[model samples]
Target: MAEEGISPSRQGRPSMTSSMRSSSFLREHQQYRPPSKPENHYGIDTVVEDLQATSIAPPRQISPFNGIPSPENPPVIVESGVSHELSHPNCTPVPGTTSFDRLVATLFYKSTSPRVSNAIPSPIRIPSPPKRAKSPTPHTESEIPPNMSPSSSLDTFPLEPPTTEPEPLDHLYGSYISPMCITSFLHLMSTFPLPPGSTDLNSAHRCLKLDTAHGHHPLVVELTMAPAPSLDYLSLSDLRKHELIYRFEREWNVDVVLRSDTLWRRYPRLVVFDMDSTLITQEVIDLLAATINDPPDLAARVSDITHRAMLGELEFDSAFRERVKLLTGLPGSIFNELRPVLDVTNGVRPLLRALKRLGVKTAVLSGGFLPLTSWLAGELGLDYAHANEVVIDEATGRLTGEVKGRIVGKERKRELLLEIAKKEGVSLDQVVAVGDGANDLLMMEAAGLGVAWNAKPRVQMEAGARLNGDSLLDLLYLFGFGDEEIRTLTR
Candidate 1:
């Protein structure tokens, strides 16, 4: 009799159908031979250029995921752009958006690897292996399941930002380090007084560990002859749980991030800023629309579109096109005139300076215009900027009302965040994205931490953090900075 899982056809001697199936599988695989010989098939010139990029680069700090590259697996090379499959699996690499390092494991593996010469890229080329813990069915050449595609089973999963949640104490303490501002923490400590042995915050920059505060259990003072405590706390674990973490957030009026110390500090290696109403006081497009006052009706029409777009009522790209079309007759001089009055939000200058001091990388990713994003980067001391280009009619010296490049919309913002983080050699979780609009949400959610700064209600509710304060400098407080540190820096 056939076993429960075994088919009757395969239970005894191999059936005729089984032999036919094997023959068919062999026939299918025989056709999948290398498309071309390794000597000259693929773009060796691009490969040579990529090799040159790594050869010149200095040895980089190894990633936390895989300290060293795996000998067997290599970075995938999809020279031809990729269309994300319907699944959009972690292994799939989105052209222009997929981080080089993030695509490494998925891109290059023996089973589905592209035939490349021995000269492989480095640093960006090391993917340890697929990091998923779940054991799925093994991949076979004969049958390419969508989920097991080379794009889906990359050796390593795309690293996601680590989240804080209820977990064991040992694991939490392992990643526990600093960044909870000393001033606020100390203030809480004075009232709460830490358990006998845990963390000491007497130092300025980092917290020193006095003791791990382990190897003890407790009985309430009411049951035992032990002395009573002020806050009615028993064990050190309780202190971290109920007081330092939970109550501290409420009393201090700040969200305490409970993530890996290394990842958290590393992050914000790239801090992406949204342009309109975020990095700038005014939407440049809206400002441009207001530039044409002679045709009052056109200006009002454009302004209405701009207002609706900013309010998340209208689509940004279409609104942008319509607004630019209104300015078609306006001379390019209007942009220059508007540039001087273009205020980089009231407190952004100092905030940018403070970030520089912290060694955090900053980027201005605007859906506005490349002209403005680039100019703002210069004034704000930002490291990078990205946005759509505004094509001008050289003959007319006026707006063309058309973008020369791809529109920097919601998906593009998210992609830029990933690209910037990968280029900066940091994980997405180690980055911070701040924005105030609907377009900003995609990028915001992509970062290690998302901060909503006086944003739309939908955004505020979804962002990881929110700042409803007077100055952008208050952002320092989110990193745990106290009043004293903020004043000294500003002064």
Candidate 2:
């Protein structure tokens, strides 16, 4: 500085260090040199090392002129002080590259973009899934317009295409759900109105169509079609309405009319008979003992055990053993002799002929012996027969005091009844069961109509219907059979 030349110690700064230096002097003397490029040696690793080393060192003393807070003992206020100083006028951004304005604009109006408008707005409006067509509205008699013809009405509406999606709202709320329920509903609804050109008499007997959305169509109607009563021949309309009711009762409710007319007029397609007492008067076991010439005391014991076994009191095997033990010495030849002595009950041939002529499937499922039952099945033209076999001692050719194979007990009998119905291609409701013992209870319970034909006290109590005074033909009556039909069936 003494000679106004560059000093060796002032190599880091320009000579115009004094604040009183004029702007012109600074501009004239200042040598403006562009910054030279640094050597390409400091990499990301070197920069990280430098930063870590600096972070470990004691903080540098901040200048008051810098307007930054002091670095106190713990330096707790350093971050806050630096943030505050940067927010002030001293911390200006570099020009052209740094954009504080753009950042602020982004923060303020982020959601106002057109991209967001293209997205879904409400959660509910997010497309609804397609649904299946609803079940067709059930048709009632009232739904048929009085002047419209059914054929014309049918032609007016084409069959709807089947829906592929899940079921629609109406089906989720409709009352007529099942096929059976729809059938019953339509049947009941038919009683209300008659279609065009349909008389009450014709409408009462005609079948009605039941439509469903799920491709199920069925015809529902009464099982029988009979002429309606003539108002002139049985006129009681002038009398009190109750008197008309009584008069109708007098015509329809007469036993002779129902028994001799209605029931025999409407015969069933099937007839089933119980083996023990219905087809045969005496229980097969009693005839077996009589043929063996066993003592009365022993025969009575066997009968008691047989009864208990039939009533489901004792296990079939156990009861059978107990009964056979009494006949241990009885010869096997007695079975052949007993077969003929077995009492064929009254109305046996006539009942079988009637059932066969009616094209009815007749079966004999008994808790009795197979030999006896199979013989009867063959003789009576029975469709099927299932029963137990008595085990004989092979060496002695006499009773072994045991039963072989499955015991046709109550439960087994019930199983056989179902199997028969299935094999015969008949509805369980069309099958008939007739029995006279307590053991027959389960089979009776399973059948469509369980008739106790002159049954024991136990059997009569459990059966659906009872037949005492009438022959086996009385079963025809319960099936809506009339005397004319019964006569045709018998013939």
Considering every candidate listed, which one attains the maximal lDDT? 1
TM per candidate: 0.48, 0.45
Q: What is the lDDT of residue 203 in candidate 1?
A: 24
**For model 2, what is the alpha-carbon lDDT of residue 335?**
60
Q: Supply the TM-score for candidate 2.
A: 0.45
lDDT of 2 by residue, 248-329 (tens): 2222211111111232224445456668888888787766765555465777777888777656566766676666667677
Q: Which digits, one per residue and each the tens of the lDDT, describe model 1 over residues 84-111? A: 3232134566677742110000000011
Separate clash counts for every candidate: 9, 9
List where candidate 2 sits over 4 angstroms from the true fold: 1-270, 292-296, 308-317
lDDT of 1 at 449: 73
Worst 10 residues of 2 by lDDT: 101-110
* Worst 10-residue lDDT window, candidate 1: 101-110
Q: Please list all clashing residue pairs in model 2, or write none if there are none.
A: 263-481, 263-482, 264-481, 264-482, 264-483, 265-481, 265-482, 266-481, 266-482
